[model samples]
Target: MSLLDQQSVFSAMLQAGPFAVGDTPPLAHPFSRETKAWVQHIHGNQLLKTKYRSVRNQIFDLLGIATYDEVLALIHDKELRTKAAERAYLLLGNMFGIEGTGQEVIRHLHEYARTADDVISSLRAKVLAPYSAHIETTNEIVTTWDPVELLLALFDDRYHKKARFEAKRKLALMGLAGSIDQRERETKIGEKFLTFLNFLNAFVWSPDCKIGELDIRYLYSTHNRENFSCSAVKVLSEEEARLIIPAVGEKLTLVKRRRFRDNGADIPIYVTIRKKEPSAKVLKLLRKNEKNPATAVDDELGLMAVLNSVNDVKRFVRHLTRSAARAESFMTLEDISDTLTGGEYRGTATGSSGKTSMLKFFARTGGMRIEFILHTNRSYLNYIYQRDVAHDEYEVKRIFDTGVIEFLFPPDIYHLDLQKIRDHQLAWFRRRIEEN
Candidate 1:
């Protein structure tokens, strides 16, 4: 009767009549332009950072996990050794975009489990803080706020402190204790975060993220990209849900699954197990949509994958900064204050509303090179309607102005597997997208 017994627990949990299969209704979008525009960072814990897909894939190679999702599920386990594999999986994934299926994940699982300092951290800073409502643009004016400032305001309220306390708990669960000042600590957690971000991209959020009175701020930056792609990973109620982890560790003990809500109000989902093996389904959709055959795919796609990744990153960083600055002008309405107090207006505070580009985007380091993603919020869609902004036109200009994005993960990501910076060039073009 070791805690989290596999067979009995699985039967009881899986066979239970009360357990939910899933929600067929689409989850609420958390990062609408309004919500996302305000959020620059997801509350800095030093271990958390801006997760890039290129870095995520590279880590897939080091720790021998199939994907970072598995690592996330495993990290919460009490069995340290089993969970160590999950962390290693993240390391390996950051090193290489893809890892071999079965044997390697198991083979390296032991070695990674043995290490004393298995978990690492990654730190990321957003150009915008919660109060910022403007973006600095060469052409358009922007506003900005410092997250530290928001933290100051939050210190007065118990709610913010509680939120931070929970954040700290999650960091500790990942073996990331109190904050570290060194870049080294950041690199450790950052790699893991990036990999996890890939696995949890579905929950990353929308351009808009309004969490009650808390305004998660984003930078308001602008670029000229006109066309972009958006990826959605949707699981229906009847679909099987599996946990993703690469290895096992000392504290990797399985526990019960708990439902939690994300900023947008969608509940975060995960798998629970009590034993050695983690639960996960090899991504069928990505595999099926993959244009390249398995044999011919690895090298051709791998090389271009890393290259295009570089380009997408550069652009995201550029635009994120711009977007973060865009929300400075919006002041809290006096009427809202009065309404909250039944017309007894309190002194107006800044940052009630902010603007965000409905166009959300990212660069994917892939089994195939996924160059650009242009994700936009339809909230401000009405404004663009009069201008007739074409997505294509915007993309062309963005890439032309910003060049290409690149991966910024730490070294040993793949131990030179993906370090190839072979001759790659970006073509020059003027393009724009219509937003009607």
Candidate 2:
């Protein structure tokens, strides 16, 4: 990350201190002083302390270090710091490079004040644009106007007394209602994400070599009959999805109800894709700093496959390896199936919570590294429907669990009770899953 970006993050942290709402002054302190204050605040709060350490440990692993001492020692080692900075750039700046210079965060309160109108306007447009046609369907709101827009606009236009109280009350109940200043950043990141997905499609279905299905059959648990294997050939729309095979419909519905949009089970492929959003990318970078942009890009194109049984999953993986070998593009593979299948849930986010079981590995081929997660029917069901283990719950947990929510939308300025919001989101996701 750039110095400016670091300062921006630090400036935001300062605003989270115990100052009155909108009463904090400009960040005029030296970097060390600002960092000290931030550290003091974190250390003073038990929850923040635990979450901060968790985030630190993740970053330490990404940087290939083990302790805080090494992190502090980097300042004196210019050579190591330069290399670390490059890695940090690749890690944090991976998504559209927006966190750094592309479109830097507005660090100062004065800067935000100057752009308040634009920020509020842009946020209003963003939150409403996607849900405009169906905004009323969302149970979160009962009024004609969105609470977030109304709150921000009222707060911005000098209606401070009521706005402050209402904003605090609503935020306490709802979490950070909408984003603050991520105006064009989301669109840029989404465009890149789509391009990355397209590249994955080309790689998987290339003319020279392609990932294909095996001719093997398995006695599906639901059908109790042997069925031919199938690969993901095409995506399905809601209408086509309605015509899903009876045996696969339930699993397909579970996967489709996931928060991510890039997944479907119209065919036997049972594939799900994962690409970190702009905010998620930033939070992940804040978690850990890895080697290169390849890891990030590979993650953006990560693929998951759910099959009838463990035997079938292994067969499918064998077919994948065989296809890669035939193309002479195979590099290496990591099979952690034994570990996951041994009743141990794989760690996620902070490496402590949001766990799930799956046969996971990474394959390097054709100058690209792709991750593949294989799941048996039973495990896949557990992944989606299991209590405290469902991915939807995981998604809701990680944001607040890692303290990224507070870092990005501090309670003092945003007036958001992150824990309350987490509960609301988790309940909301569970309701959607139930409806599905």
Candidate 3:
């Protein structure tokens, strides 16, 4: 076998062998800090994070159970997997980068099927097979659900032969609903309290929020955890802590979170839906507000202001596609310009071929630099080059020294719809969901 494969087999054998019963070290630190760090990396990664709705979604993929960190803490608690199949399921998911709550739970109802009748024979048979016994509905396109029974069914094994109904149900829902900031509080504290207050107050954190903390030793060094404490974790929430100390000694702490704010952390995007008000009216509201929206730099690297690093656009195209009625709710370029005192917003471009592109700030919460690219309006020359092409070209050229500018506005430059962009991101929760 290849070196990587050999190492994996060795590791599995180590994990599956009669580990604790032997003279061997029992694979001390069975999991590496890399695993912990990678999870933390996902939590800190703004782009990957923006793809997820909350931390619970990540936990579902990371840990088969909502409280994966709890599993980590089990090192201190000494919980063992009496049922290896379910443990294998979680292990394989982690090894293969297939952690998200995806179509698998629904698609494999019978494929690779197993049964409880064989649980007593082997860990593979017991855990994997018994799980198949609790099949509900299966389809290529699975409906999203929060079924308590489904989760309980996963734990059916020779060891955990009978499931804990209420316990399993609450655990499943916690992973389904919890956010990243909530995940952070399991270790540190700051944003969580602010978030809980916001949920109580009815306002919430900015979508793709940016937060940071600085290193105080040099006053402005790259590693300033102390100085940037308040800004470290971006997503925040309020919650009632519910931690259960399993008799097995695994402590599961779940906080149901609510509340948020625009703490001006460093992040790439800050999105908020404009409800009821016409897209044009929303700009007027922002324009009239005296509190200027903070940029990624104000609270991050202090290099580029957050405004320079991010674009605040109101466009959810997938929603528009499914509901044609919502199309009219989109904001126009004029509205964006009017919203800022001197906002430099080039018109959005859409192509006849349905492509798009635009200029935007790619890095946020850090350097907040700007770059031009084609997105959304992938081939929308027909949208911008029709009868108004020459006239608009002259107007734009008069505004820039490059008497010329390529329009990538229709599709590739500036377009983001959560549902549609799935095909373009790396996810642990869902498999190959990005359709493009």
Give the top-scoring candidate (lDDT). Answer: 2
Q: Mind giving the per-residue lDDT tens digits that candidate 1 earns over 1-436?
A: 2111222211111111111111211112455553363244324522222332333453344334565344434334447434454555555434433357645543433322221011211111111111112211111000111111111222223233223322222222121111111112333434534443342233222324322212221212122232222121222221122332212110111212122232234322222111111000001101122212232122111101100122332343343233333422211211111121123223211111112222222223211121122222221221122122333233323222221111111121112221131111111111112221
* Model 2, span 227-335: residue lDDT tens: 2112212334566656665444233433331111112221244666776443333334333332122333346447788765676666666656665665566657854
Cα deviation of 380, candidate 3, in Å: 6.8
Q: What digit string (tens of lDDT, one per residue) describes model 3 on residues 1-436?
A: 2111212211111212121012211123436764454456457545444443353364354344555444433323324332322454544334434435545432222121221111112212311122233321222112222232233233323112122222232232222122211222232324433432333123223333323211111111111122111111112212211222222211121112211223344222222111111111211111222112121111111111111111322222122122222222222211212212233335432211111123333221111221212111111221122222222332322212111011101112122232232222212111111110
Most accurate candidate by TM-score: 2
Name the regions of candidate 3 deviating beyond 4 angstroms.
1-436
Global Cα RMSD, each model: 29.2, 14.6, 25.7
Against the hidden true structure, what lDDT does model 1 obtain? 0.24
Alpha-carbon TM-score of each model against the true structure: 0.15, 0.47, 0.17
How far out, in Å, is residue 304 in model 3? 20
Sort by lDDT, best first: what order? 2, 3, 1
**Residue 123 Cα positional deviation in candidate 1, in Å, after optimal superposition:** 29
